[model samples]
Target: MSKDSSQSFLLSDSAMQAASYSTYQNFQSSPTLCASELQNWKQRIGLFQTHLQTTATPTQGSLFDTTSTQTSLDSIKPFELRRQNTEFWRWQFDDVGVPAMYFVIDYIATAQKGPILLYIGETVKSNQRWKGVHDCKRYLTNYQQAHRDTGLKSELAIAFWPQAPADRPARQKLESQLIYKWRSPFNKENWRYWNTPFITGKEP
Candidate 1:
């Protein structure tokens, strides 16, 4: 062949070889791509099987298991009042007379911790205020005295969780749970339970 024709033929051959090598590489990689796709499909199937098994299994304590309505924490409504306020007294005399769980909170202590649950109690009668001069009240009185003497910040507050008039037992149970959770200082029942010292302005 002439010199130019020979160069053109060599270029065409090189291009053909490159195209063949590219096709060979793609062919070699095809199995790996198929394997990866198959693995992904297997994982998806496994997940689908797990989901089916979970859906088919019966869960204990499901809402539908009981004929009676179950009360959840979300169902409990909370109300707050300053212990010294007239509104606190008025709330006791509310005409509905619902059972309630009450919490004596030190709002000042709450500034350090979350709401300092000083004491917890429940009453069947809405009108009852710590059952007319209880140990809880005495504790509060002593704390107030310390506040006056030492100029300690004392912002005592009360919170109530009123439930249906007939749900006194539930209210009491909730009160016990709150006392256990908060380890309230003045609660006689929790005195032996938490065994933790009271966080008060006074040492003892």
Candidate 2:
């Protein structure tokens, strides 16, 4: 394997170790929720579980075309972004973060979906974004529980783009474009396409 591949393997292993250790701690304290996690599965799982029940039924709408998502030459694919070095820990780490275009991703790939891009966002305060009130955090809770309930593996991590435009308006415009392009399920704009269960009373 190449140098980059070796580093990636080490990173992936460390993330797994962190998650395993956290999960063990959570299980020791509370069966359903971890200290790092904001909400309990019971609180968020109900809606997602119900939605999963009917996923077999045919749906009419189309998901955003992730295959067509693009980035400037200086940028990489959303899935290509890694934790810390570029991504910094969105879950368990120091809150000091940088201005970046960020992605919330499920690293585990299934034959059906490959790696799941749950949300795409841009933030001047990438690390501090979750430090304040953020709805996306709750959505992520549900999304993870949805996977767990179905025995699906999910390696949820946040990543960043160092090349994001410095201007807030320009950065936000790029964020909007990518969000629409990927139609990431947790993002409100594409929630309808995925039958996102966490949306209030709407089944988006």
Candidate 3:
């Protein structure tokens, strides 16, 4: 549930100077523009590119089922403990712990006569190589076959896995037990499904 480590990298003085020089020189050829305007444009472009390159990955926190925007993004930290190196953190799975899939339900509309639950899944394998879960539809197929009128349908969200051990049978069993014990709203027909309200808040 937590990150493996946190390490911050500070750019060397020479490297910083070089980067500043490159940014300034990029606008040097614009003879038709005023100096102030050129500097402002460069600053804005730099900020925009930074935004695109650095997104808040799932490791930092969940998206909370909201659309990404300047405000939401600003609410998140620019630098995270998990983002050590771009390539290293990207799709880095947890291999020694829970080597299995996990789900987060996006929404549960209890107001309706037949409310729906949005379930998202993640698959964790060894080698710390993380990938999105694609078997949500397949899992729904199996669930539907077992119970024709359970009314559980698949509504997949952004997927990613954690690092976990190869001996994952325990994880699968735990998931099954949790699902049964909680009687997740996923199984609407069950009396335990949606019996209580679920609350989520924006965590800092």
lDDT of 2 by residue, 1-204 (tens): 244322322224465455442121111111243422422322233244234334432222343233332315213476666653212333553344455787876665343334556678887755456554456656655555655655656666767665566689778766776666555667888766665555332112
TM-score, per-candidate, Cα-based: 0.49, 0.58, 0.27
Q: Tell me how far the alpha carbon of residue 81 in candidate 1 is from the true structure, in angstroms, after superposition.
A: 7.5
lDDT of each: 0.43, 0.51, 0.30
Residue 114's C-alpha lDDT in candidate 3? Answer: 19
Select the stronger candidate by lDDT from 1 and 3. 1
The clash count for each model shown is 0, 2, 7
Backbone clash total for model 2 is 2
The TM-score that candidate 3 achieves is 0.27
Instruction: For candidate 1, give the lDDT of residue 58.
Output: 29
TM-score for predicted model 2 compared with the true structure: 0.58
Candidate 3 per-residue lDDT, tens place, 36-55, comes to: 44234324433432443455
Rank ordering of all candidates by lDDT, starting from the highest: 2, 1, 3
Least well predicted 10-residue stretch by lDDT in candidate 3: 21-30
Best by TM-score: 2
The candidates, ranked best first by TM-score, are 2, 1, 3
